[model samples]
Structures are given as C-alpha cells and as structure tokens.
Target chain A: MKHDYYPPGIKGIDGDYTAALAGNPNTGKSTVFNALTGLNQHTGNWPGKTVTQARGYYRHRGKTAVIVDLPGTYSLSANSLEEEVARDFICFAQPEVTVVMADATCLERNLNLVLQILEITPKVVVCLNLMDEAERKGLKLDVDQLADELGVPVVPTAAHIGRGIAELKDKIHSVAVSEILPRPKPVTYSQQLEEAIRQLETSLQRVYTNGISRRWIALRLLEGDHSVIEAIREYSLAEGKGAE
Target chain B: MGVDAALNLDELIEHGRELRNKLGPETEIQDEIVTSIYRRAEAIASKVAAQAGGRGRDWNKTIDDLLTSRLVGFPLMLLLLGGILWLTISGANYPSNALAALFFMLEDKLTFLFLRWQTPEWLHGLVVLGTFRCLAWVVSVMLPPMAIFFPLFTLLEDLGYLPRVAFNLDNIFKRCGAHGKQALTMAMGFGCNAAGVMAARIIDSPRERMIAILTNNFIPCNGRFPLLISMAVLFLGAGGLKYGSAIASLTVAGMVLLGIGVTFLVSYVLSSTMLKGISSSFTLELPPYRRPQVLQVLVRSVLDRTLFVLWRAVKVAAPAGALVWVLANTNIGGMSIIEHLAGYLDPAGRLIGLDGFILLAFILGLPANEIVIPTLLMSYLGAGALLELESLSAMRELLLARGWTWLTALNVMVFSVLHFPCGTTLLTIKHETGGWKWTIIAVLLTTGTAFLACLLITQVVQTLGLLF
Candidate 1:
C-alpha cells in the first residue's frame, strides 16, 4: 500500500504499524496497553483514571508497532469527554487495527463497546484481558468460541503478568497486513432502528465510495451525534459531494 | 399482538425500570431512549456471555454502600481526617524544629560573613536579616508539615478513598442544590485552594462551579498549615502532657471539619440565592479498592505538592522578610515602624483577643503565611537580632515572656482557620472567576467571617470567664 505522506521527523522502519488500543472503563484495558507496549502507562484501579491519551511503541519482527491508548469508556455514545475522544479517533483518524480491550471478568458489559466499534470498521482485534481476575473467581471462557462468535480474533490475556501480549501483537500485525480478514455478522438492533440504518446506508452508498461504513454513520445520526454528521459532511466534501 | 411485539413491549418496560433505578425517573424522553439502548445491549450480552461461579454484587458497590452510609460516613470521614492530622502534627514537629535550627545557624554564619566582607551595615541587615531570614523561616516552618501531610493525603487519594468521600458528600451537595462533584473539588482544596478552584471545572453547570470556586478558600491551604500547627501547640499544648500534640492535632482536625461544615452551609445559601439552580445528578463511580502505590504516591506528592507549595511560600517570604526588616528597623519617634503599626492595631486587636503585633503580623503575612510567626518575632526582638531557638520549650518561653495568653492562641487558631487566602490563592481565584468581582467577594467574605467569628468567640470567653 502506498502511504500518502510520512511524518516530517524521520526515516521509517520497514514494517511500522500504528494501532489504537481502546476499551470500556474498568476493563483492565491499560493493563493490555501497557503489556503490549512494554510501557508503564499508569494503571490505577479507578474508573475515569486515564484522562489523557498516551502513546508507546514496541518493535515486533522488525516492525515498530506504535499504539495509542484512548481513555476507557462504557460506550462510544459520546456522552462524556472520554467517549468523544475514543469515538473520534476510531472514526476519523482510522487506526490500522483498533484493538478493543475487554475485561474477561465482566465480558458481557465489556462487549457493548467492542460490538459498537465492529460496526465502524472490520479491521479490529478484541483483547480479552484480566483473565487472572476472572479465573480467581472460577469463570471459564472458550476463547475460540468467542472469536468465532464475533468474527474477529479474540486473545485471552492476563496482561498484568504479561501473558498473551506477543500473540496479541502478532494477531494485530496479521490483521493490519490483511493476512487475516474479519467478517463481523452485523449486530441487529430493534427492527425500527435497523430499517433506519439500512435506509441511511443505502442513501449514503449512492454518494460516497471511500469504503466508509454507512451503518455506523446511521446509528450516530439516530443517536443525534453532531460530530459524526460533521465527519460525514467533511468526508463527503473530500470525495466530491453528490458524486458517485 | 404477535409474540415479538409482546416481548419488545416487556423489554421496554423492563428497560424503563432500569433507567429509573440508574438515573432518576424524571426526564422521561431521555430516560426512555437510554433505557431502550441499554436493554438491547443487555439482551445481546445475555445470548453470548454466561455467568459462572455465581457472580455476587460488585465489590465496589458494597464498599460504596458501607463508606457512604449515613451512620458510618461522617464518623469515617472524621476518623480519617483526625488520623491524618495526628500523623502530620507529630511527624512534622521534630523536623520543623531541626530545620529552624539549621537555617538560623546558616543565617548567623551568613551574617558573620557579611560583617567580614565589609558590607555596609544597612545593606547587610537588609540582605541577610530581612530577605534571607524570612525565606528561611518559610521553608523551615512550612516544608516539614507539607512533606508529611501531602504524601499521606495522596496515599488516601491513590487508595481511591477520595472518590468515596465525594460519593458520601454527593447527597448533601444534591440536597443543597449544587453539583455532587463539588465534594471532589473540595477534597482537592484540602491540598491547595488554587487547585480546588481549577478542579471545579469538572462541574458542568456554571452556577455550581462558581459556588465551588467561591467556597474553596474555606478549606485551609498548605500555607496556613504552619500557623495551625503553631497555634495548636501554643494553646492546646498547655501543661505539656505526652498527648499534647495529639490534642493539637485533634483541634486542627476539628477546625477542618468546621471548615467543611461552613462550606456546605455557604454553598447551600449561594445555590438558593446568588447561584440558583436544580442539583444536576451525576454518576459517581466507586472504583474497586486497590493497594495504593506507596512509593510512587509518596514521591509524587512530596515533590509535586509539598515542595511546590513550600517554594511558593519561600518566594513570597523573601520579599516579606525584607519588608518586615525595614519596618522593624525604620525608627519613628524613638520606636520602629513595626512598633508604631502594632500599637495602632493593638486596641482593635485586643478587643478581638489578639494583640497589636499579632494583627500586624497577619497584615504583613498576607503574601505568605509561613513568615507570620517570624515577622512577629522580628517585631518583638529588634530586626537585626539573631533567633536562638535552642528548644521547643525555649520557643514557648519567648512567647510567654511576651505576655501571650490562651486567649491569644485561640484567636490565632481561629484566624488561621478563617482568614482570607494568601496572594497566590487570591490571584488564582481572580483567574478562575475571570473577574475582580468574585475575587473581592471571596476576600471580603473570608476576612469578615474570620473577624466576626473571632470577636464573638472572644466576647463570649470574656463574659463566661473561660480560660480562653
């Protein structure tokens, strides 16, 4: 793939990939972020702890894997500062592989964020983190079953003790290189909302062809997200408004 | 209706109940929408995830319940505050005395060096005795207590108890028609009033944020810690029992509780009058308890807060010391300028149970609180004289020899707790408020409250023949 423009500062390594690590708050997301990057990104056991976005880089198989840690939030609903930043980064900045870290201890609650992101982009890896905490309470998970269910690679990780970080990075690298393809079965909301999204997507598909998913935009529109509307307008303008 | 329609309607009602439980039942439209989304998400979750080992209520929820319960919350808050104050009072005394000794010794050497260098007498006095001694006093008196208090406070913060404090106080704030997050901002104020004002930005509503900014000064800042400790020692340390320091610490902690009580009362009045608004509900997530990072918190708190506040006090104290030196040395009608000023303020001061010099010290001490005692000392023992504080007992003797009574100590304690903030805090309030109006209001309110409260206490004591 030919890159548009390299940053001014330096020479690039052969296989450098910049990834985004995102998750819901209290999901042990920072643990995974820190483990993967070999960085001590301050991990406090507190919700709303990581207010500022943090970045760290690691080299894997001659590729400089740079990861940005977005603030953990319950959803990409943009109800709070953390949500807005996380949602914007995923939609606009478009990281190569957005790794949605979820807590194995509370997988059900954590999946809401992952499912939302999957609607936006297919290039994703779900990190099942805090396996130790889950196991301590005698909870068992079939990782392959989860991966098959989500149509995305799911890696179980005890990130605090550095388990599964290597496999996670390899999976991310593979996904970024298009060696692995994700086929997410679109999560259906209520029939009313689904019909609205289908209508919006069909209308949007007639006008733009930059591979942007319209279903995501439609959900955002229904949610009354002004930023997403602005993003769509900006994208439309860049691709020539009203052009097929 | 079809089976699907019935299921959807049941789900919708279940969702409504969940929303009613989570957020309030008001704002029906928003609540309904949010509930629908959450219900859909929960339905999806149920299909894929299975609960194993019978997951109980969240530990965070349980802890929040215990900590924020009406019966336990206030007592727990007091117990923690008292414990921290006790640690600060006892931990700081030895180091404070040691620092004072070391700095005064250094001052004597510098004074001798100036004499040897053939520096002009007035210039030597201005440089060494005025500026240097003043800066020394601030660092010696203020640094130790801050070093002890900040790290301990940070430990509690790191342990995630601070949020629980906010959770506990959220109900009261809501009742008072203020944002619940005001409790978090007030906790920040316990470290520094300026930071507290900045933290008020967490509050979304302008009215509640303004209330937080205005009332931040009611909490004592780092600069006032030395005065509190010193006054506590002088008054509450009478008869010299082993637990004298403990008594002093308890007294300071009581003053802190009183400040918090006043903050709530003032915030209530303001919310009702000047800044009227309905209390907006906010989510206060009680984080899972974690073992505090002891070393990291200690280092960060000491370096970031303790030394930082100490540095500010030192900067202000240097000029203040020079000014005090000039005031003490500049003779007017056979007495120094400081003597004339003290005599002028003495009558009013006596009426409030404080003397002229104490009031004059307070006036000069506006820049930084660390130098207040040193300034008073300079006024008593001529400006050029060296302080030979041989012991804590000796230091006590000096004050007693100056005819200081329990009444004076009580007045100073009251003043320290209630006085207007130092210059830095005033400037911060101006910046935070974005105008002179609120700044002036903050100053006047705190100063007036301090004076009225002190005067009333003094009159009551005099009338009742209390030792104070």
Candidate 2:
C-alpha cells in the first residue's frame, strides 16, 4: 500500500483476493482505491485521463488483497480505450469483487455504469461515494433502498473524509468470500432482441468459459463490440483457432 | 454432442452478427442497450435518491462566472500564475545556492581525490569535470525550483483550476479556428508536451488535432520551465529578496503569457493555411472545485515532478555531460572540437542573437530539453567547466564574461520556447499522427519559428538601440 515498494510482476503480487474499482470521472473512484489500498494515485485532473492501469495492495482481515483501479469511464461501451480497459479487466481479469463507485450527488448517471457492470459480473459492490458533497449540495441518497433496487450491498461512503470506508471494506470482503451473493436485477430488452440474445447466450455458454456473464457477452456481440471480439481472441478462447 | 459442443467461436460470432442484422436497421441496438441500462439506473435512482434545495450550488456558479468571465478572468489568471512563479523563483534561490555550495565543495574533494590517486587528465576531466559537474548543475540549479514549482502547479491542477484554465481559453481557441479542447491539450503541455501532443486526440477533428499537435511546443513543459525561470532570474529578475522574487516571477509569467500568445497565433496560422478548418466546439465539463488533502498534495507532487526531474537528470544529463566533456576536451588543430563546431555555427547563431555554443547546445539538447542549459554552460566555460554558481549573480558573471548581453538571455528564453519538441515528444507526434510527414512538419515548423522570431527581435531591438 505504501510507495516505498511496488511489487513488480507476478512474483511481487500474491493477493489472496483481487478487487476492481470502477467509476465515472471525478467520482472519487481513486479516493476509494487510495483509502482501501493506500496507493497515492494521480488523483487530479478533472475528466481524468486514467488510461493507464495502476495497482495497489492492502491487507484486510488477515487476508492480503490487491485492488486494481480500472480507468474511469462512463460506461463499458468499448467506444474508447478507457472503456475497453475497464471492460476487459472486469470481464477477463475476473476480479473477485468489482466495486462500482457512484457519486452520491449524481446517482442516476453513475448508476448507469453500475447497471452495465452488473450485466457483466454478479460480484458487484455499489460504493455510493461523495456523501459529503451530496449533503452539502442538499441531496440525500437512501443507501439501503438503492441496494434493494439493484439487489446488491450499497455502501454509502464519504470516502474523502474516511466515512463509510470500513463498511465498504467489509462489504468487499463479504462479497469476495461469497458470503453475500449479489443477484443484480437484469434489464429487459425488446422481445425480438431478447430472443436473439437468449439464443446467443446459449451458444456463448457452450464456447465462452471465461467466467464473464454469457448474457453480457451476447449483448456485446449483438452490439458489434469489436473490443470484446479482440478480448475474446486475446484470451485465446476462440474454437476455430485450434482447428485451423 | 462432442462436435456440436466445440461450437466454432467464429461461427457463433457470425451467428450473433446474423441475429443482430435480423433485428433490422430500425432497431438501433446500441442505442437501445444504452437506453435500457440508463432506464434501470434512473429507475433505481428515483426510488432511492432525493434532491432538495441544493445549498452552496449558486456559490460555485458565481465563482466560475468571475473566473471565466471576459473582464475579470484573464487578470485573475495572470495574478495566480505570476504569484506561483514568484514563489518558485524566490523560494528556490537559497536552497539552490546552498546545494550548489555543497556540491562544488564536494567537487573540490573529488579533484583532490583524483590528484591523490594520480588519475590521468582525460580520466579526471571526463569523470569529475564533465559528468559529475553536469549532474551537480542539474540537481542544484534545476531540482530545487522544480521541487517548489511542480508542487505548486500540481496543487492548482489538483484543485481543479486547470480545467478552468481550459474553459477561459476556449473562446480564443475557437477564434483561432481550433477545437475548444486544444486549450486542454495546451494546458497538458505545461506538464509535458509529449503528453499534450498525445492529448490532442481528444480534438476528434483531424485538422484541429494536427494544429494542436504542432503548436504544443509553444507551451513550455516543466523541463523548459526551470530554464525559463533561471533566464528570467538572471537578466530580468531583481534577485531573491521578497519583491525581487515577485519581479522575477512576473517576468517568467510574462514569458509564459508570450508563449500562450504564440500558441494562439500559430494555431490561427495553421487553421488558415496548412491544416485549414473551422473550429469544432465541445462541451467542457467544469467540475466544482475541491480541496486536496495537504499531506497527499505534498506526497503526490514530490512523487510526480521532483522525482521525475531527478530520474531525468541521471538518465539523460549524465550521458549529455560526458559527450559535451569529450567535445570540449578533444583538441582539433589547437581548438577543441566544440569550439570548431561553434565557430562554424557562430554566424548563423549570431543572427538570432545567440552564439554558436548556445545553438550547438540546443541541437545537442534535442534529446532532452532539461540538458540544454547545462550543456551550454559546460561548453561555454570551455574545458574547465569549473564555474561555481553560489547564486544567480555568479552565474550571471560567467555568462557576461562570455559576451552575453540581456538580449542573449531574452533570445535564449524565446528560442527555448519555440524550438522543436524534445525527442520523446517528436516520437509521440510520429506515433500519434501515424506518419513521418506530419512529424517532420511539426519539427520544422517549431524550429523555423524559433529562428525567425529570434532573428526578427534581435534585429529590431538592435536597430532601436542604434537609433537611440
């Protein structure tokens, strides 16, 4: 967690669990990472360019954990490099728990990302951040209600002031230990599109054993997301490759 | 079941595509996906979050207004910039002098050690006089100001004022027929031009993006910042007393203002000529200001800028020192190799109000802008490179002894501002633009501007002096 030494390569990183932090720009996603992992990330620059990946580790509850701070992005649309990275890390890197940090002030916009991330992984912990900013702005969020709606554990955190961080860590641990199963509510699509996705998911489940949600893979494939195509190839899971 | 279980991945992808196409063109599948996700988000938020009369919201609007307004904005910007520069200049003097005194004293011990060990002249000259001296100059002269300046600058950045800077400059960029995002890229240039050039990708308009890439060199990066600060302190500054720092800081601020002016002018020219295009507009998000944690600020600044300078000093300046040392020490027909090259370049250099040594140092410094001033000093002091800089005054005396007038100092600062992007930046431009042609154009454009501007200024100023 300290800057004195960053473990290099596979040898240095021996985390009992890997947790991923994802969020929109300026949502204090890094503040969450730094609070949890004590990595002094370059947490400046509005509309920040976190295109580069940064990793840090911290020990929690007698277990060493590594937190990979994904690039800040609005959604996993694979339209930009940041999106591609965030998507690939959650989908392929297969972190034990993915914490989606949402600014409490603008819960709607930030939740859009949480929904998209939910489609990809069931182990998503919604960390509602910037509670102080929201309160100062005269806004209030019902954390329990948000969790109930999303069917996940939503931890309200004023991360900058060290508020709700312990609970966030606890939620991350419980989620990582599979003690708290997050059954995220899925979005419904048009009947025709839904049928297509259903068939694609069935086909995808047979071929894609990469641990990513087959339904999310089906949707991305339907959306002509080339990045997922690249990711699928990069993991070298394509079936025809072994044949030819 | 075995053959079917294989489920050729390519075939599944093909099947997915076929199903997607079957949904028909009217479906707008991506839009539907986005909207569906957003719908779920809105549904969740409406059920959970509540908004009342947002307190302290109007205050943010009021400040942003004054900070970005036409009348009050620019003067305020200049004041903050000048104040930061002034602090860096005045604050760094004692530490720089103390470090210099400490290092030079060590250099003497090193000389005694060489004498005691009976090392050869070439060996001593290369090791102690050349490389070690250059390293000392870089650390003592360059490091302190950077340690002061970068933290201050990063503080502004961390406080989210930099985006406000982009917001203030947006109108001018639009007027220049460049993208509004070029302001952001130029702001990036203040940190590192290679980063700034890479940031040009946000422009999205090819012509405007190219303009941003080419004009990025006009904004001084942190490497050039120390050089400018030292130059201003030498000729234009009053020295490091309180008000003295103010004067020096304002001078450097003035130089930065000049560089920004050049960026706009060049952006205008490029938009009109080679990379002709209308300005593309963008919605710049101005986030509410936040107070950075004080301890975090110190740690982040030291880690980012100060450490980077030290790393660069060792990696780039060490080798530069040995090369310059060899060039200065190697005899060619009774003149050192550096002198001979300088003599050949002297005429051209003089036209631009710089001597051949200065120009040669700049050429040699193309690999790293941080080394230009050090290389110039190493060769200008001749083989000795033994000049001790206890203060700016001592350095001034050395420069004056070499026939340097205030004009030379001014031109050096200006030329440093306009010269070609560093080797890293040039490579970045090549990679970003994806061609050698645009990269070459960028180098030529920036270097040509430096020469022409320096030449014109020297001529006009000298003519005025003559008339008086």
* Candidate 2 whole-model C-alpha lDDT, 0 to 1: 0.83
Query: Can you give the lDDT of residue B294 in candidate 1?
Result: 94
Candidate 1 per-residue lDDT, tens place, B343-436, comes to 8998988888888998889888877666788787767766334546544555677777777887778788788778787777789889878889
Q: What lDDT does candidate 2 reach at residue A33?
A: 85
TM-score of model 2 vs. true structure:
0.74
Which lDDT tens digits does candidate 2 get at residues B1-468?
324433457778888889988987524998898888878888888888776875565667798899999999999999999888888888888898898889888989998999999999999988987899888888888888888888888888888898888888888999999888888899889889999999988776788889999999999998898899888888776434556666778778878888899999999998899888787655566777878676788898799768976787668989999999999988989999999999999999999999999999999999889999889988987644567665557888888888888789889999999999999999999999999999999989999999999999899999889422
The residue ranges of model 1 lying beyond 4 angstroms of the native Cα positions read A1-18, A24-66, A103-109, A130-142, A145-150, A157-163, A184-213, A220-227, A230-244, B1-62, B101-124, B340-356, B383-387, B400-403, B433-437, B462-468
Which ten contiguous residues of candidate 1 chain B have the minimum total lDDT?
Answer: B1-10
TM-score of chain B of 1: 0.88
Model 1 chain A lDDT-worst window of ten: A1-10
**CAPRI band of model 2?**
acceptable
Q: For each candidate, what is chain B's TM-score?
A: 0.88, 0.88
